[model samples]
Target: MPVITFANTKGGAGKTTAVLLLATELARMGHRVTVLDADPQLWISRWSEMSGEMRNLSVISHVTMASMETHIRENRSNTDCFIIDLPGTKSPLLTMALGISDHVLIPVQGSAMDARGASEVLEHIELLNRKMGMKIDHSVVLTRVNAMISTRSMLLVKALLAEKNVRVLNTPIAERAAFRDIFDCGGTLEALDCQKVSNVEKAMENVRNFAYEVLRLMPVRVVRSDRDGKFLGRKAA
Candidate 1:
């Protein structure tokens, strides 16, 4: 399984939202997805509880540095992708997760503070690469973007990432009411009521594109077994 981690050293950068979108989308696409909720706030865990049981999707709550690897090792065979939601602060867990992850996604908002938080994460990854020779794959994904207009701060953030030579996904998670309502409604975007939420279709499209970009970076290969008519998943080489 390819472990993809959503991490930022600062909170309110839409880290959890990105995690949920990717996990739900991948699960909806028939890939077994396991989410490790390492955030102490337990947002993902609470969402899972509210969402009840979903097919092809599982959430492990209260994951810590000590239990992180054990959980991944135990669930490796069954999961096609492992999404790790790290806490929004500077912690040792960030380093540990970075080392193990196949790709680290740092969600950054259109503000200086968010940029600084992303910088901390990028620095940590660099440290791992330089000090330990662990060149972890990573990218900065812009989140909570205004769909209608590009603010000056957003442009600056993009420029900064370009200046730093950081790879950023072209697709950005738009600021949508449906993105927030999913937390309260406790279901995937497909399960949400279009009548109750404004621009639900647009929100779903954004997530679809976001998930598509993520899968492009870290793909899961599924092959069929001729004898048993079963499908086996492996991380793409």
Candidate 2:
């Protein structure tokens, strides 16, 4: 199973939103998913509980690193994917999650300030990769991007990090009220729109594709994709 941890050193980076949305997308694609909520805030956990019936996904709260690891090890055999929503700041739980993660998705707003804060998280990942034999996959996901801002802060950061050979997913999540409003109602992007707001629809499409791309990098089971690039399975794997 692939274990993906959404982590960052700074708070208010949309970590919970990313985790909740991504997990919903993955589950909708038909993959057996288990979400481990390491944040003491339990935002994702509560959201999952309130949302109720998810087809093939399960969400559970694990406050400590030890418990998280134990859960991963014990349930790894039964699950096809594990998505961990971590706290904003560094903690023992976050460290343990990183140590066992197959991939780390760091979501940041497309701004100079957020870019600077992201650097610290990137540096720590680099250190972990070098010091330990762990090969943790990672990528930077640009969030809350405004198209009017011609100068793309995320693109600039991607250029700067090119020398390090880090990969940035092509799909940049644009700022959308749909995303912001969905949290309160516990709704997924897929459930929100069918015809209107094409941009938001396309953004959700990109998110689904990006999730598959991350899975592909890990050499996990390739999800069958149709001509439109949408995964054909009930969930992504």
Candidate 3:
């Protein structure tokens, strides 16, 4: 299994929503997923409480720097993937999480060029690489994207990422009512009412594409036992 952390030094970068989407989508694909709710806000924790026993999914709330490794070590055997949702603001926890993560995803709003928070995360990663020779894999995910048109701000952000030579995900998370509604409703995108929410099918499709791109970056191998057809993700070699 691989540990993927979603982090941003600034708030409202759409980090939590991306984490939820990836965790839920991976679980839906039959991989056992554990989400560490490292954020103080407990958004994912509250959502998990409301979800009530989803198959192949688990959530550990109130995770801290002290307990994060313990939780991962304890759950490694059962988890196919571990997704950590770090705090919105800069924290010592960010460095600790980034140090251990197989991949760190920094979510930047596609509509705005306010990548200051993302820059902070990038700087930390660079410091780790320079000071400790730790080459941590990471990518910028353009979130809250407008599906209709590519705005000027978004293009500038893309250019800035290119100038820095940072990898960006091919799929951008689009702005959709369903994405917001899932936090309020406390379930997967599939669980959303298609009739009530506009463009739910499109939202689901966008999530699928985003998840697929992530899987390409840090693939998890899953297999089924002969005795029980349940899928089990093999530990990363």
Candidate 4:
């Protein structure tokens, strides 16, 4: 299983939102997903319950650093994908989550303030990797971006990318109220009313593509799909 964790050192960086959306998308695509909520706030846990798909979804809430490693070791065999929703700040629990993650996705708003905080988190991750001699794949996902505001910040982000050698996914999530409004309803992006905001659909596709790229980088196995024995080729990373 590929264990992906959504994390950042700053609050309100949209880590929870990214995890929820991406996990839902993967689940709808037929992957057996297990979401581990490592945040003390338990926002993702609450949202999962509100989504009313808990019975069908594999979601474990109120997980802390103390218990996370054991849980993963015990349950990893049964899951195809493990998506961990982490707290926004650095803590022992957050560090533990990163230690075990196959990929660490840091969602940042397209703003200088958010970028600065994200850089700090990246530095910490690097330090940990060097100290422990463990390779932890990491990337940045830009969210709540608008052409008007992003035009300038995007340039800043590009400059940082060049200087720091950080990877930024090509897909930028646009600012939309629909993203927030859909949480109360039970569905993934595929089940949303796409007619209202087609852009969201495109954004989601970008996310899925980025995820596939991460999977490719890690060289994880892509399972083939068989619908009533009509075999489809292995899914491309």
Candidate 5:
């Protein structure tokens, strides 16, 4: 199984929203996903409560630094992927989660251009690499990008990140009402009613691309089991 952590010390950077989209999408693809709701607000846990028993999806709430590794070890038997949603402010858990994560996804708001929070995370990763020699794979996922934004502006954001040698995902998460609606409705994008939600199809496509890119970047070996007729992820020991 692969552990993917979303970290941004700055609040309102859309970290939790990104986590929800990726977790649901991965579960929809038949991979069992366990989300550790480390955020104090417990947004993911609340969303899971609103969401009725989704197959291959589970949420562990009130997670702490001490419990992080224990949750991973205990859930390793059934979990295909572990996603940790960290708090918005800088804390010890931020470093603790990053230390265990296979990939740290730092969500940066597009309109706000909140690079400071993302920079903090990047610096921590660099420090770990330099001081402890721990190389953790990570990326910046641009979120809440306006659909009407100019091509020039989007390119500029890309240019700025590239200038700093930051690796970013090609698929940017667009600002859409459907993304907000999911938190209220408590269901996956595919389950959302097309007539009720506007631009739902486009939102689904964007999330699909994002999830596919992450899967490609961190390829987990999936095995087929005859007993349950479901896939099991194999992690290297």
Candidate 6:
């Protein structure tokens, strides 16, 4: 089972936006993606209610630390990918989610606060690896990047992340209005009217790249079948 967990200790790191982008894109690709909305804020849940019906996509709200694994076990039959959206603040739920995740994505901005928040999560992941040998794979994704140009400051930060031996995604999420309007409009990037939203096509391309990298980076493992609960190939292209 490939479960991807998105976590950032600091709010405003664009974590929720990235989660929605990946979830919708995966569903669009014909994968049965189930989003477990663990965040009390329920942004994804609200969006799901508004999205009406998305093919191969479902959202389960009010997820708790106690019922998280239960939901996974029960849905193991139908879910192709489980995406968990954690709260911005660190809590016991964070550790619980990380324990069951196949991969962790940390959204970092070119700011001290975002970096600090990401670092905290990384340390926890490292701790789990060192102590329990969990071997949780993780990467840092730069968010809200300037689309027109990559500033030298951003490059400096990227270099710093590299020096720390952190894996950074080649694709940085651009600061686009389409990403913002999706929350209000209650649909996906494809549903947005390109004529109205600036760079909607560009945003779609960015999301495609982001999702491609995500699928490439996720581990290929045999998991329970959606129908029979037997081992099956989920990484098939």
**Which 10 consecutive positions of candidate 5 have the poorest summed lDDT?**
220-229
Q: List the residue pairs that clash in candidate 1.
A: none
lDDT at position 16, candidate 6: 89
lDDT of 2 by residue, 1-237 (tens): 778888877888878887877787777776668999888899887777777877767888865766887888888765677999888886777667878887888887866666665676777777887898666778887777674563556667667657667677666666776667566666577676556534667667767876666666664663534545454443333
Best by lDDT: 1
- Mark the regions of model 2 whose C-alpha exceeds 4 Å error after superposition: 147-149, 193-200, 222-237
lDDT of each: 0.91, 0.73, 0.89, 0.73, 0.87, 0.87
Q: For candidate 6, write residues 1-237 as lDDT tens digits.
A: 589999989988988899999998877776678999999999999998988888778999999999999999999888888999999998999998989998999998888788889988999999999999998989999999998887776777788889999999999898999999999898899899888889899999999999889888877533324543333456443
* Per-residue lDDT value at 5 in model 2: 86
Angstrom error at residue 41, model 1:
0.5
Give per-residue lDDT, candidate 3, residue 116. 82
RMSD of every candidate to native, in Å, equals: 2.6, 4.1, 2.2, 3.1, 2.5, 3.7
- The lDDT of model 2 is 0.73
Badly placed stretches (over 4 Å) of model 5 are: 111-113, 151-155, 223-229, 232-237
State the lDDT at 70 in candidate 6.
93
Cα TM-score per model: 0.95, 0.84, 0.94, 0.85, 0.92, 0.92
Q: Judge candidate 1 at residue 72 and give its lDDT.
A: 98
Q: How many steric clashes does model 6 contain?
A: 1
Best by TM-score: 1
lDDT assessment of candidate 1: 0.91
Candidate 2's displacement at residue 82, Å, is 0.4
Q: Candidate 1, which segments miss by more than 4 Å at Cα?
A: 219-237
Clashing pairs in 4: none
Residue 133 Cα positional deviation in candidate 5, in Å, after optimal superposition: 0.5
